[model samples]
Target: MAYYTSNAEHPIDIVNIASLENRVKARMDRGAFGYIREGAEDEWTLRENTRAFNDLRIAPRVLQGIDHVDLSTSIFGIDLKTPIIEAPSAAHGLAHVKGEVDTAIGAAKAGTLFAMSTYGSTPVEEAAAAAPEAPQFFQLYMSKDDGFNEFLIKKAVKAGVKAIIMTVDSTLGGYREEDIVSHFQFPLPMPNLAAYSASDGVGKGISEIYAAAKQDFVPSDIAKVKDMSGLPVFVKGIQSPEDAIVAIQAGADGIWVSNHGGRQLDGGPASISVLPAIAKAVNHQVPVIFDSGVRRGQHVFKALASGADLVAIGRPVIYGLNLGGAEGVKSVFDHLNMELSITMQLAGTKTIEEIKKTTLL
Candidate 1:
């Protein structure tokens, strides 16, 4: 059977990433795609996430005479030419051998920020070196070892990482039924595990290693890293208004609202749909960013209208990497940028700030 069928326009050209996801699903092992959960276990939350967006109708304004567009924004004191940021994912090497290095370079060349995953095959320092001029944030995974967590944080900070993003939603791995059926395992093992266990000198004062392990590799508190490094901190995997408020109270500089691209927790509110409530809860105390189910410029626009200060792309870039490596990743960003510029022009908005709720329809 054919893995994919393409239109005359192009082989990769499809309506959106979701379509591409479906195409890939047909050829790949069952463990590769869809809600990780099995059976009828996920009926409500998974469906609700996508359905929430449908319930919202964009309210647009006409006759604004838009021209001279400016697409610039600042998040966590870092200026970005565009509001798009690359969402962190594990082992870009699975997508391509270049892994996070390709992603870092692509985001930097496109004049945006890149988030480096702790699970990436490329080391944080190496990824940072690839795009020394680009703004980079290190994503932290609380390890089963507290000492290891501290070591990773200190290493990231020493590597010139500007911000720390704590992924709190993944206390345990998601129930990916696809992986379960196919026995799909993460291609890259934790190479840093032994190094982290041996390094006791780092992150010493932050917390006792024994205390840290109790939380199952997730930090018991964000203050441990914040107080130790004094870098701006962001909390990812946020979904509810209460959690948003809690994150801000915990000294989060930003809240990255994501449902792990619907990979974890098979059913939940779509990241974009809950952005408004989360933003409202934060009340501008910090930036609220989004991920999951975003594929086009309009999706970015919708996110902004719904209160996302910035939006991130996850799977599309991965697909691009799978198809063409570094150049492919760059092409994905370029395509999105062009689409965004056109969307802004049509909405009668000239700049990022001009994209108000009225621009949506």
Candidate 2:
């Protein structure tokens, strides 16, 4: 069952992402809020994702003859007006009415990429239709049922998804005590599974896929997606340099450095902490996507300077959805775009390429 919650009693007065987050808290009940806010087990890695950013300070350059900053960039041939992309998050029903579809449309209006989660409440086809022109990626969960996984990919292709991000972490569900204590059951009527006409034999829904996938999931499976689907494929959940190497060797087109937002494993190294080595390991062979605990605009700047080709946001996007659906998300993106532009201007970096490790202290 899906935990569909209610919105706040009043309209949100957005000042920053934090304010949006507070609104989410005010709107959602204990279970709904805890589901998004809590991390796996003790949440050691969860806290670290943010603390790692605080540990680094930016060394700003002044009087370098930069009048304006341009945040335009591209990944996998998709042009982005800003360096930020909405990271994939599933079950938007807990946040808002429309769920992933709202975020997808908001991303289109904001001129950025949106990766629809495999567990999204809205079907990929319907969500893709929400923003027909936006560059969208289908985040894949390598189902125990190989054919079911392929069926999901085929749906993405038919829906004009730009790429496929196979999540390497989260093979098994996290030990989120928050959900257990709150008794938060997932909402019913999953559009993705409901729409999935997998006649090839299945139990019920995604649980079976996860059950079949406890030990057998591997990067070679990601390689197969690249080879067979012919789509630009990336491996998400690369936390270490060795993992990045393995992913590249397995023929991944890109590496997404994340700790599943510190939701999959507790007591793991922060996402940002492991990014520099992973970025260096890949050595520009493929785009390095970064995520986990990206809230403020300066956080986005930090990720770019550290080595992220593009920064994907998760919680903030969820907050925006809960705050005001598409409009809320647009506001979040706009604020991020402005923050990054200001950071570039203040730091004396005029373009995305100008953002490098040298930009940091």
Largest TM-score belongs to which candidate?
Answer: 2
| Residue runs of model 2 more than 4 Å from their true location after superposition | 1-13, 197-209, 212-214
lDDT of 2 by residue, 82-198 (tens): 989999887776788788878898889889998988777788998999999999999987766667677778988899998999887877877888877876656445566556643
lDDT tens readout by residue for model 1, 147-200: 667888888888899999888887655554544455554434334443555532
Model 1 stretches astray by more than 4 angstroms: 1-15, 22-51, 197-220, 356-361
How much RMSD separates candidate 2 from the native structure?
Answer: 2.9
Question: In the order shown, what is each candidate's alpha-carbon RMSD?
Answer: 6.4, 2.9
